[model samples]
Target: MKLLPLARQAEVTNGWLRERLRAVLPEVMRRARVDLWLVVAREYNEDPVLPSLLPAPMMGARRRTMLVFHAPEGGAFEALAIANAGVGLDGFYTPMWDKTMLAEAAEDQWACLRRVVAERNPKRIGVNVSAEIAFADGLSKSEHDALMAALGPELAARCVSAEEVVVGWLSRRLEGEIEAADGINALAHGLIAEAFSPRVVHPGVTTAVEVAWWLRERARSLGLGCWFQPSVSIQRRGEHLGDLGSSPDAVIRRGDLLHCDFGLHYLGLATDTQQNAYVRRLGESGPPAGMVAALAKAKWQQELLAAEMVIGRSGNEVLRAARAAMARAGLEGRIYTHPIGYHGHGAGPMIGRYDNQEGLPGAGELRLQDATLFSFEMFVEHALPEWDGQRIKLATEQCVAFRGGEVHFLGGRQTAWHLI
Candidate 1:
C-alpha cells in the first residue's frame, strides 16, 4: 500500500480538524455541561487536545497559545486563537490577539481571554483539570494560576473540570478517520508479517533485539512511526518466558513459539496489535494439535470480548459480561482492552488492565460510544497436552472499532499463526 504524501496527509488531517471543530466540539461541550472550554498551553507543554485541534505542521503551541471554545445554546460555537494573526489559523479560528494588540495591552493573552469571557458571559466555564484521566489534566500550575487571577473569584467560581469534554472529543472517531485508520492498520499488519518471516529472522543467528530493530527500521523506511518499541519473545517447550520475560537478546530457535507486541502511528491515528508465530522445525508439517487448540481458545476469547461491546454500556459492565460468558464457556483468560486512536492507549473507556482485571475505577466507568476504536488485548491460559502437559498463555491484541451497533476488526483479527 502507498503511504500518503506529507502534503496530502496534512491536507487530510486539516480537513478532519475542520469537521471535528464544526460537528464534534459543540455536542461534546453540551454533553459535559460546559458552555465555554479553555485550553491553555505553552511552547513545549501543549494540552493533548490542542494538538488535535491545530492545523497540521504547526509543531507545538507557540508562546502561551490559548484556545477558547464557546458553545452557545445553538449554532456554531466560537473558536478563537489567542495568538499572532500570522499563524495560519484564520480558516478555523478567529485570531483574537495580534502583535500590535499584545504590544499595547498590559497582560496580553490574559487580557484577551478575560475580555472574551466577559463578552460571552458563559454560565459554565470548563478548564482542563482532572485527577481521573491524564489526557484531560493538561492545565499546568502557572497557567491555572494565571487563569484564576484573570477571572477573579466570581468568574472562577463557575469554572469546572473539562474531563468529560476532553474524553468525549478525543474518544469519538470521525468516518474519515476510521477509513484512514483501516489503511494504516493494514500496513502495520503487513510489516509485522514480514518481520516475523525467514527474510528477517534466522533461527539461530538472529536475536529478538535484531528483529525488533528491523521492524523499527522498516517503519522508518515506509515513513511511518511506532508508538512503542516492537517487542519479540519466544516461548519454548520447557521455558515459559512469562509476560515480561521477553528479553531483547534472546536468540530465536527452531520450534519456538514467537510473540510480538507492535504498534504504528500514522496520519495522527495509532494502531496496536499483538500476534503470534511458530517456527517449523526440520520435518514438522504444522504446529502440534495442543498449540493449535490453544490458539483457538484465544480466538474464542476474542469473540467473547467483542460481543460485550454494547454502545452506551460502561467498560466495567462490558468486562463483567465478557467474563461471565468466558466462564460459561469454561475458558481461563484475562482481558485488558483500551481505546486506541489519537494515542495508542487513547481516550475513552478502559475495559480491563493486565494486573487489575477486576476493573479500572474512573476510566473503566466511561461508557462506550459508536464510531470509536479499541485494542482488544487479552490472553488465554491453558494446559498444552503436546508439550508434556505444560501450561502456556496464548495472548492476542487486535485493532477493532464499534460502529453501526456492532464491533468490526479494522483488519481482520489474526486467526492462524504466522508461520516462520
Candidate 2:
C-alpha cells in the first residue's frame, strides 16, 4: 500500500484541524448549549481533548495552555489561545496573551483569562469537568482551584461541566477525516491479509506469535502504528474453546481455525478490527460446509445490527433491538461495539461490552448522532458437525461511519475467510 510522506501527512492533518475549528466547533457548541468553553492543560500533562485540537507536528501542550471558545448570544464565535509567547498556535487561534505586559507587572495569565471571561459574560460557562466521560474530565485539581479563584465567584457560579461539548466535538467526523479513514482501514485489512496468507504463515512451521509480530512489523513499515498489540490464536478439533488460542507457542496446522485482533492508527484516525481465517487440510478444496454456514450466520447477525443503527437512538436501545432480532433468528453471539477516531476506542456511546450484553451504564446511555464512526464488533459461535459437535467461534469487526441515517463501512467487511 502507498502512503504519503510524513511531512505531507502533517500538512493534510493540519488542514483538517483548521476546517474542524472553522466549521464544526461552532455547531457542536450550539448543540451542547455551551456559550463559553475553557480547556486548561499544562505542558506534558495534556488533556485527551487537547491533542485533538492541536495542530499537526505538535505532540504536547505548551506551558499553561488555555484554550477558550466563546460563542455568546448574538455574537461572533471565537477560538482563543492563552499560552506563553511564540507557541506557534497563533495561526489557528487568536492569541490573547502578551509576554511583554508580564515584564511590566501588568497582568498574569489567569488575570488575562478572567478578563476574557468578563468581557464575554456568557450565560453558560463550560469547563472540562465530568464524572462520566474521561475525555471531558481533563481539568486537574490544582488547575480547577486556580481557575475558580481567577473567575472571582461571579463567573465561577456560571461554570458547568462541558461533557456534552467534548463528546460532540470528539465523536463528530468530517468528510475529510472519514475519507482518510477509508484508506487507513484498507491498510489494516491488507496487513492482515498478508499475515494470514502463505507468504507469512507456513502451516505447521510458523507459530501464532510469529504471525502476530509480523503484522505489527508490517504496520510499522507503512508508517502506521498499532493502538493495541496485534494478537493471533488458533482453534482445532477436539479442543475446548477455553483451552485454545492462549499459548504463544501454538503452531498453525492444516485444518485449524485462526483468529486475530488488531488495531492501527494513522493521520489522527484509528481502526479496531477482528477477523478469522481457515487453513485447508489435504484433499480439501475449501472449508467444510459447517464452517461456511457458521460464517454466513455471522454475516446475518451483522446485518441485523446494522439495520438497527439509526440516528437519535441510544446505544443501549440499539443493542437491545439487535439482541432481540438475534434471538428471533436463533443465533448466539456477543456484541461489543465502540466508536473509533483520534483514540482507538474513541468517544461516543458503547453498544455493549463482551461481559455485559444486557446494557452498559453511563457511556452506553448516550444517544447516537450523525457524522460518527464505530467499530461494529461482534462474534457468533456454532457447534460444528465436522468437529464432532465442538463449537467454533467466528468474530467480525469493521470500521463504519454513521451519516444521513446510515452506516457505511470504511473498508468493506470480510465476507470470505482468508485461506492458507
The whole-model C-alpha lDDT of candidate 1 against the native structure comes to 0.87
Q: Across residues 1-420, which tens digit of lDDT does each residue of candidate 1 receive?
A: 588899999999999999999888899899888999999999888888788888987877877788999997875699988886666677889878766423554457788889889889889999999999999999999899999999888889999999999999998989989888887888889998998899998999998878888988999998989988888877888986555425458788988888888899999999998898888888988888888999999999999998888989999999999999999999998999999988999999999999887888999999998889999999999897877888777888999878987988887668788888
Worst 10 residues of 2 by lDDT: 239-248
Give the alpha carbon lDDT tens digit for every residue of 1-420 in model 2. Answer: 888898998899999989998888888888788999999999878789999998868777887899999876667889998887666686989988776424532578999999999988888988999898889999998999999999999999999999888988999999989888888888889888999899999988998889988988999887889988888878889854333234367778999998888999888898888888999998898889998899999889888999999898999999999999999999998888998898988889999998899998878999999999999999998999999988877888889989888988887788888899
Report the Cα RMSD per candidate. Answer: 1.6, 1.8
Per-residue lDDT, model 1, residue 208, is 80
Q: Which residue segments of model 1 deviate by more than 4 Å?
A: 100-107, 242-245
How displaced is residue 190 in candidate 2, in Å? 0.6
